[model samples]
Target: MFKPAEGPVRLPSGQRYLGLDLGSKTIGLALSDTGHRIASPYQTLARKKFSADAAELQRIVAKEGVAALVLGLPVNMDGTEGPRCQATRAFARNISQLMPLPIALWDERMSTMAVQRMMTDEADLSRARRAELVDKLAASYILQSYLDWVGGQPT
Candidate 1:
């Protein structure tokens, strides 16, 4: 079965979905169960060489039974691709070689800021605490956005 970058993707129908919020220093993780109703934050991985990162990601995919991957695309404010977007695509291409899962790139313009704001207002967390959790929380945000869109919520 084939999966598109957006919309309803047809997979094997029994595997979980994985979401990745890739950053300069860390990669946030989120997982969706086979039913794809809810998405939960998983973990954050410190950035490293591509080989090492791919290995770690492979481990997560294996352990979580991930059928497809959702990658957050850091597009510019004007909705144009920039250097960061290029980097993300490069990373996606490289990872697709190691694991052939369908990859979807979701817009991630304000995901980090939204996560930080949520941490600050809802949790009343200190700056340091927010920084520590921002990546993984952003992953949750990304996954939630994708899920909402897939559920036919307005964009």
Candidate 2:
């Protein structure tokens, strides 16, 4: 399921790519449009045990007809891998074992910070609102970047 995407990925109609921004306490989810052109914030799942989390993700994948997963990889700003990155890699490996889908590990440096700044500077949301919105929004940002990257690839 964790096959390398050497070529452009094609999915069946009505299927989508699911983006995940994994946090210690919660996992934010974004769902790509069926056309694979846009991603939108879907929901936030509070983290439990790994098995429980995987079960919930599997449920969502089935419900949304997810074709693949784009998991945010929290690499350091210096382009170095760290414990967070290791944790993400492990999560991806575990999730892939649970589901049959190609997984893309997208660099997510500062994704949460970027979303925080947007909420503060542009949206002018209150602190509580920003806290409530940051996770899912970050997932969207990660997915959008992945989609843009794929778009830039030559057909």
Candidate 3:
């Protein structure tokens, strides 16, 4: 029964946040700085059984001192919730049962495409290399978007 968080994300002092971009086959991860002002690409996790994936995430949360989770919500361009959006919500709900961290869903339309374009236009990375890096980079983009939004809020 987990719901996407409303308003600004608040956490205990000294704790960071974890950003997740969940794909059908892989999960991209990003980590925020202790001050929650910056997000960096972390790692990618291959999809596995729900229990195994949750266990790994729990372990990472403990190790990384993560206080909250920002999950990319793949809404359609028309602002409609598609199957992918439903799946992401389901994952959030299920993960909430396993871990008590607050979860926020950020609209992720065009996130991966934007990252791919950046890699091609600026980084000039090869297709194969971009494939290897896109997911994690996209996760960073998503997390950075959230951080920027928070930063713009009136304190």
Candidate 4:
């Protein structure tokens, strides 16, 4: 019953959204407040078998009362999709079969880089510390961006 979301995601009151940043070795997770105004870093899941990953996600969705998902879609600076985009889409398709929720693909160009820069320049975190936090923080940024966009949409 899961399908790609085409526009602003409308959620029921008291429900939340989950944001994801999929990497080769890990998947970063973020959660939105029930009001859908703020996104906070949740946790990072190490990449494993697809079934295991999806199961973990399902558990989070149920526990968090998540109503939908906002998954980062990495695109080139020139706005062209490449292998990474394809992989993300494939993951979405696979996960949808298991979880019935709307999935919005948000352009994630430079999201990681932006997070890295903020951690290094503003936070002044060591490389090890940044490495530990960047993925989840990037997920937060992606989710915040989506929420902001949704807020601006016509009611």
| Deviation in Å, model 3, residue 150 alpha carbon | 1.0
Q: Give me candidate 3's TM-score against the actual structure.
A: 0.97
Candidate 1 ranges beyond 4 A from true positions: 1-7, 153-155
The residue ranges of model 4 lying beyond 4 angstroms of the native Cα positions read: 1-3
lDDT of 1: 0.85
Q: Please report the TM-score between candidate 2 and the true structure.
A: 0.93
Worst 10 residues of 1 by lDDT: 1-10
lDDT of 2: 0.88
lDDT of 3 at 152: 88
In TM-score terms, candidate 1 sits at 0.91
lDDT of each candidate versus the true structure: 0.85, 0.88, 0.93, 0.94
Between candidates 1 and 2, the lDDT winner: 2
TM-score of each: 0.91, 0.93, 0.97, 0.97
Residue 11 deviation, candidate 4, in Å?
0.7
Could you tell me which 10 consecutive residues in candidate 3 have the lowest summed lDDT? 4-13
**Residue by residue across 38-146, what tens digits does model 4's lDDT show?**
9999999999999999999999999999989999999999999999999999999999888888999999999999999999899999999999998899999999999
Clashes of 3: 0
- What root-mean-square deviation over C-alphas does model 4 reach? 1.1
Cα lDDT tens digits, model 3, 50-135, are 99999999999999999999999999999999999999999999999999989999999999999999999999999999988888
Q: Tell me the deviation in Å of residue 19 in model 4.
A: 0.2
**lDDT for 14 (candidate 2):** 76
Q: Rank the candidates by TM-score, best first.
A: 4, 3, 2, 1
True-vs-predicted CA distance for residue 24, candidate 1, Å: 0.9
